[model samples]
Target: MNLPEILADLQLILEEYQSRLDHYSDQVFMLSPEIGCWSMAEVYSHVFGTCLMQQKAMEMCMQGQGMEGSAGLNEMGDKLFALGHFPPGKYEAPEALKSRVQNIHKEDAKALATKLLSRIKSVQSEDILNANEDQRMEHPRLGFLNASQWVHFMLIHTKHHLNQLDRIERKFSMC
Candidate 1:
């Protein structure tokens, strides 16, 4: 997609997430309904980590000065999008990433959301978007993904957890 289109979508996604989180009370932000469920703050923290990782990968690829294959060329990457959403199941996040969503204060969540938004904006330049698509980084599940696909992952990942946030909110309200 073109730079303007991508940037606009990214902005919208980021703003929507930020606005939703901003409206929550501290109790709601930190309340996990049960042993496995994540509170809204936890969800934000997790999405922040994923977005940060993707941003770093894209920056590295852009710095390498190569633009190769497009995103959907990889079978695994294609399958991820083809599913139209994150798969339904409990996948374990790596230990390092698991801590991301824990022990977060409401203020911390806001800061993280802002940081994520800034990271998205940082990659909006034409040069970065036009960078070689061939360069890739290892994604734990999807294998190697190019810079563009990494950006796509950032968008999709947030949306996925945002779904979780909705469920968490609904369930927490009943408690």
Candidate 2:
């Protein structure tokens, strides 16, 4: 897909996520009926964390001469997901998410999205298609992803969390 399409989808996903947060944040964090599931607060935190990590990847890809070459992100991600989450994919439960990690997490998510948008806007077409394969970046969890996979992973991961965000909206939303 082209940049326009990729960006368009990202915008739509962000809108969906924002709407969910706006509708539910005021109520209380957890999936409603107070089921004590993953809180809206926690979901927000996770999405935010993931987005920040993604935005940070560009820098790592560009600068971190560490071991996280192209396939690094996937390998690390698969392992992390395998350890903590249930598949097909589900956000970790709030108790599972951390007690002290509320407001800070939410803020982190916002910062990540904001930064990601800034960096993404600066990406030239050539940069996207022409990044070196063996060129590597050391991410916090997933090590590195070649340029193409990183782009794909970034979009794919955003959509995945958007789905999670949607679920949180449905379960906890007042509407």
Candidate 3:
């Protein structure tokens, strides 16, 4: 997607997430739908935190700090962008990163979501728009992506989690 489209979608998804924060009671937010699954709070925390990290990567690219090379997206990255979303299935974070996912408070989650939205908005500046398209950062699973691709990935990632959120809510209602 183009920058404007990416920004609009990002804004909508982030606002949707922020609006739903109040819908969850503390118990529901912290409740895991099943054993070995993340609670809604953990999901929110992970999504927002990962988006922020992606934003920083974008910023680094804008500042010309990205790796200088003709490195292109790996096969997985090409497929992901072509599909414009994650494939259906469960994905596990690396073992080291798994511990970073925590049961966050609803208020804290809301604040992080807000910050991510703000960061997305800030990326519309001239510098970010003019960032070196050839410069790239490597994502462990997805391969190297430039600034615009990073923004697109952020949108895809958040939308992917909406389904997970729905499943969690449904499980909560069933209990």
Candidate 4:
């Protein structure tokens, strides 16, 4: 999607998150609803943390600080871009990343979301829009992605997590 479209979608998703936050009681925000599941706060923490990392990669690529002569997006990246979303499945966080989302308070999650939305809005320069595809960062699984792709990935990633948020809310309501 184009920058404007991406920005609009991102804003909508962030607003949705904020709306949920507005309605959640402290107990509901912190409840997991089941074993081995993330609380709503943890989910927000994880999404914002990942988006921040992706945003940094996009900035690096736009500034020509990405890996020189890097091979572009791999097959999976191509598929994901073509699909415009992640394929349906459960994805596990790496062991190192698991702890980062733990015990996140609602206020901390709100702060992270605010910071991320601000950073995302700041990347609308012409340089970023026309960033050189060769200046790319390696996604741990999706291979090298340039600035534009990184932006798109952030959108897809956030949208993908909305389902998780819905599920958590549903489970909480049932309890």
Q: What is the C-alpha lDDT of each candidate?
A: 0.73, 0.56, 0.85, 0.83
Q: lDDT per residue, candidate 2, 13-107, as tens digits? A: 66566555444444454433445555666666665655555556654555544344345556656664344332464544234335434543444
Model 4 / residue 119 / CA error / Å: 1.2
What is candidate 4's lDDT per residue for 27-100, written digit by digit as tens? 88888778988888888988988888989999999989998788787898899999999888889877766767
Candidate 1 lDDT by residue in tens digits, 94-155: 77778655757778877877987887776665766777767777776676777776777777
Which clashing pairs does model 2 show? 29-40, 48-109, 70-146
lDDT of 4: 0.83
Clashes of 3: 0
Maximum-lDDT candidate: 3
Candidate 3 per-residue lDDT, tens place, 8-109, comes to: 898899999998998899888998889999999999988998888888888888778888784678898899999999999999986655778889999899
- TM for every model, in the order presented, reads 0.83, 0.64, 0.94, 0.92
Clashing pairs in 3: none
Error of 1 at 61 (Å): 1.0
Residue 32 local lDDT, model 2: 39
